[model samples]
Target: MSFDLGLQNTRALVTGGTKGTGAAIVDALANAGAQVIATARSIPADARKGVHFIAADVATSEGCAAVADGVLAAFGGVDIIVHVVGGSSAPGGGFAALNDEIWLRELNLNLMPAVRLDRALLPGMIAQGSGVIVHVTSIQRALPLPEATTAYAAAKAALSTYSKSLSKEVSPKGIRVVRVAPGWIETDAAVALAERLAEQARTDYDGGKKIIMDALGGIPLGRPAKPSEVADLIGFIVSPRAGAITGTEFVIDGGTIPTV
Candidate 1:
């Protein structure tokens, strides 16, 4: 079960590293002996030791470029870049619920950061002739939830397609690009949703959770995954041990995605 990454001295950049899955990935990379530069709009004051926190919003092209420059200046060049900074800004609505602004915001938040960062940093990785890139996508790309997150699903679908194309373009040059699609991660967001639903339904938090699960067709594992579980998959995918895993999607969803 040991991935045996031997990541000592390897430099990595993890976007959205202030909380949730991003924080978990940052911790995982640090534990594997990699020097990590974690970026977010604002870093937590009580952030863990050994991670260099950089204040930057990857949603902007300028911010992405600045982060890339800062990391290169500090670490010379990164061997791994984990794109974990995306999410939907749109509120709940079906197709008509999403306006142009919402569509643009979701695309920028969920898709553009990685595209911008790759444009800024992949050359360095290609020049070095070896690097790993992991894109954190969502299961929604395949299993679209139109009632609440149609725009989000569309944005993730674009991201998945872009990642696959980018991987094929870069893998021949000694850089590996892979994607991780997670389903129903147990994060603060989930907790908030549960609380909101509980109050609306006049039920307990667990009851709200059951309602959510039923909506998702019941997660086969009977629970959402922890952030650390997704992080573990990310850690392995970016390691040398997973060199042959480029241009593929790894779904860590507890069988929530029914398709083969």
Candidate 2:
């Protein structure tokens, strides 16, 4: 029930850390006694205590370079890097509905930022001979909700593959690369969907939640995960306690993904 975790005084960078799952991870890292720098295109109304905010558009190469410079100048290099910047704006209508621009945007949004940041920062980790990189992917990669989020799912699949390949090359150098895929986390966006579903079904909020579960083929344990719950798992992951874990995809889907 109790472990030191050994994360005191370490530094970390979390993309899209202003809200949702990313904010939860930022808070958890700070709670575990690590210096956390959170990056987003704009500043949040209230950046959490013990977390530094850097305004940068992480979807571009320029943004990644600026963040790398800022962190390198501030902390020399971080002990952890958590890539939690991803979303989908692709329209609904299956793969046919998706256009080149939408696909490009989704790829840049969900994958390239992490790739750019890693290229800019992994050298520092390699030099120090240790670091942990956690990519926040989605269960869509495996489940593929094509009609609604085909591009997003495809990009995440690419990200998962990239994370695994990078880990294979870096673990020997003491850099641990891993991915966390969540299914329907209870963030603001998800809440909005539940509200709409409730309206359509003319039922209570819990009814809407069930509708979502059913759409996903039913989550056996019954509900989506809270942001904080997922953060707790991530907190343990980047800590020294999970020193041996790397090149793996940890799914926190409440048993939504039923497979080996």
Candidate 3:
């Protein structure tokens, strides 16, 4: 048997695509023959080839507009958009540690970018009568770490709900919207953090990684996922092969959530 994504010549855009999971998604789609446009606040010197790079923050209204304008001016519209820009800088210490400003920042980073970009870009897709949207959320939405990532978790939860609502509103119009919730992904940054933890704990890198995994209530699969693994799932979700899949959340957590 053979499997094909049928992404040839398809125009796609990925936010936060300069690094980590976003970069992996960019590569996956491009390798599948899609013409990918990727965005970042600053284009790295070693940015990947085979995809157009747009420099935009996407975490602010102005930045989202710039990205939308650039893509529209160039491609008129995109067949697919994978929202991958999100993170938190809020201080850890549970609820009281976060302020209104921090809460807004989390929302802006994790939720609003997807909302703004979808609003700006969806009209073109609606006009075309066909498109796919994948919002990269986090398992933290369901399995939140109160002390460390509460705001991030809340924002992802909002994103998940928004994704479902958007799909219901747009699926009849020929747009497919899906949410992807990833668990810990072993990216380069994660590896570096593990190394730091190892030094602090007087342990090896594996032991350090184990410490973090154990804190997640233990991943039944024995380790966190690879960035490429998440990207591949997104690649398939946006493909014609997944035409009937929409208005749903796919959790790639290596069974870390520990719930049915």
Candidate 4:
């Protein structure tokens, strides 16, 4: 049996689509026959087929406007928006280690981009009276790791809450807003961190990865998730088949979160 999402001709804008989970989401949407407009700070040299690449930094209001304007001009209007542009620049150290500047940066990186994009594009979606918005949050919102990412956790918590509230207001108006929270995805960053930990601890990269997983209390599935796995869930949530699902968060963590 085939899992047909029936998203042909749908136009989607995926932020941070240059790499990692965002790239995977773009691929999934394209595979489902959606016309994908992917934005990032830089476009990859060997870009995927069936997806248009736009260069813009979503962390700034000007960048968000440029991307929205570009997409509107190219596609006329967008039917789906997947906000996957967020990360913590905070280095290791607890809350006190993060000063005011760092806190502001974290908030902007992890929260404001989505806010600005929604502000810019929601009017178009509202005018159409139908659309889907997916915000990629982190599992840190529920399981915060204060050792290095207190601000990141806080910002994602705010993003999740904002998504829920936004969904409530817009679901009655024919737009769906949802959140996806992923944990310890095995992306390029994860590999690099593991290698760095290995160098610091005088161990192999695989050994360092084991330490990291152990620190996460051991993933029940005995592994971190691939970016593609998270993308699969994203594709489902934004598809018409999931029309009844809105205003909620789906956690894809390989059972690492240890909660209901």
Candidate 5:
């Protein structure tokens, strides 16, 4: 079953749209009839039709500038901006294991792209008096895994705070700013990680998945969420049906945070 999200004829931009949750979001916004411009460092080999692709590494100032220029030149501006380009490559042991460079890298990846892009594109939205921005944060902001993902968690926490502050400043101007925090999504990378854990533990696939869930203090739903699930929620949030919503962080973690 499906419902109209009222995104027809809108222009949208999705960063990191080549894979995983970002790819899912590109598909969702496009399927809902939005003219989607998906930006990544590289284009996908199996890229689909009806979605425009741009190659730019938005972790830097120049990349964000290129994307803003491209979108404005092509479509004047976008009505929806979904910042999905975030991940941690830092070798994790704890806070002590992280150096200044590692912490800065994580912040650049998880927080600054949205900050830069928003700064670049928001004037168009403000002039037009309407837009929606969604930042893809992580559940780790609330449930930090100190041993492995402390840097990632800290970056996402900053992003959440930034999103809220942006929303407050812009909502009165007709721009909606929201952040989506997802937990334990079953993306390809995550599945591969689970598989590696399984091999190390001499366990099967389900057991490997269980190992991850156990590490997260157990997802009450007993499994990870699909990327498409996160995409669908985002679809609704950017639609007219969610017009009144702004400056909120929606958690889609399969009950992983363990609190209200």
Candidate 6:
């Protein structure tokens, strides 16, 4: 199985790869012998081994151009691209509480990065005749919590639809486009967000988690998925083992989304 991965010397770019799930993905790819270029707004305090860090915010077109420039200049082009940059800091009062700026920020963070990156880098992939692209969306797109992430959910939903559409256009040209929807991933970001939620709900962290879980219909696994688990999945999807897999949305939500 490991041999089938065939990731040795593969060139990869992971957006938002400094911390949380992004860091995990970078580690997984690096461990598999891929040359990983990880991009984020800033450098991480504890960086991963054998992964090159490039500072950039993928949410902006300028940042997207910077990434594409760095990749092209360094490696000519990346063989695999995993988009892992996105989040919501909008107030928890639902749509009415969100202003235009917040909504636009959410869209820029969650949606435009993927769109802009693809537009800039896909030509190189097509020219090379093979590549892999993974867009990390969210379960919120499907099982939305409007009070907390209405704009974020909307943005991710757009990302998912865009990924599906792009996959059909590129798969035949030897480029694979896949979307991954992860729910409640265990990360430092998740912990910090939980702390805020705990404060707002006037409960302890565990109690706040319970409240959040209850609203989501509960994770049957009784816990969020580890970032490494999702990273491993992303690693596999981009590897030769999943070469036939394309244009699909894989949900690693710990069964939080109970839909079939």
Query: Best lDDT goes to which candidate?
Result: 3
- The digit string of per-residue lDDT tens for model 6 on 1-260 reads 23657899999999989889998999999988999999998896788867878888787899999989998888888899999999988998877999999999999999999999999999999999999999999999998898879999999999999999999999999999999999988798878877888999899998777776788889998888899999999999999889899999999988998878
Q: Residue 163 in model 6: shift from native, Å?
A: 0.5
lDDT for 3 in candidate 6 is 60
Reference-based TM-score of each model: 0.96, 0.97, 0.98, 0.96, 0.98, 0.94
Top candidate by TM-score: 3
Model 2, 1-260: lDDT tens digits are 78877889999999999888999989988998999999999987878876888999988889889999999988889899999999998888988898898999999999999999999999999999999999999999999887769899999999999999999999999999989999989988888889899999999889998999998999988889999999999999999899999999999999998887
Off by over 4 Å in 2: none
Which residue pairs overlap in candidate 3's backbone? none
lDDT of 1: 0.90
Tens-digit lDDT string for candidate 1 (1-260): 87579788999999999898999999999999999999999978899888898898777888888898899889888899999998776677688888998888889889999999888889999999999999899999999888868888888999999999998899999999998999888888888888899999999998888888878878999898999999999988888888788999999888998878
Candidate 4's C-alpha runs over 4 A off are: none
lDDT of each: 0.90, 0.92, 0.94, 0.91, 0.93, 0.91
Candidate 4 lDDT (Cα, 0 to 1): 0.91
lDDT of 6 at 228: 98
Task: Please list the residue runs of candidate 1 whose C-alpha ends up more than 4 Å from where it truly belongs after superposition.
Answer: 1-3
List residue ranges in candidate 3 displaced over 4 A: none
When sorted by lDDT, best at the front, the candidate numbers are 3, 5, 2, 4, 6, 1
Which residue runs does candidate 5 get wrong by more than 4 Å? none
Give the winner by TM-score: 1 or 2.
Answer: 2
Q: Give the TM-score of candidate 4.
A: 0.96
Model 6 local distance difference test score = 0.91
Error in Å for residue 183 of model 6: 0.8
In candidate 6, stretches whose alpha carbon ends up further than 4 angstroms from where it belongs are 1-4, 195-205
Query: By the lDDT metric, which is better: model 3 or model 4?
Result: 3
lDDT of 1 at 61: 83
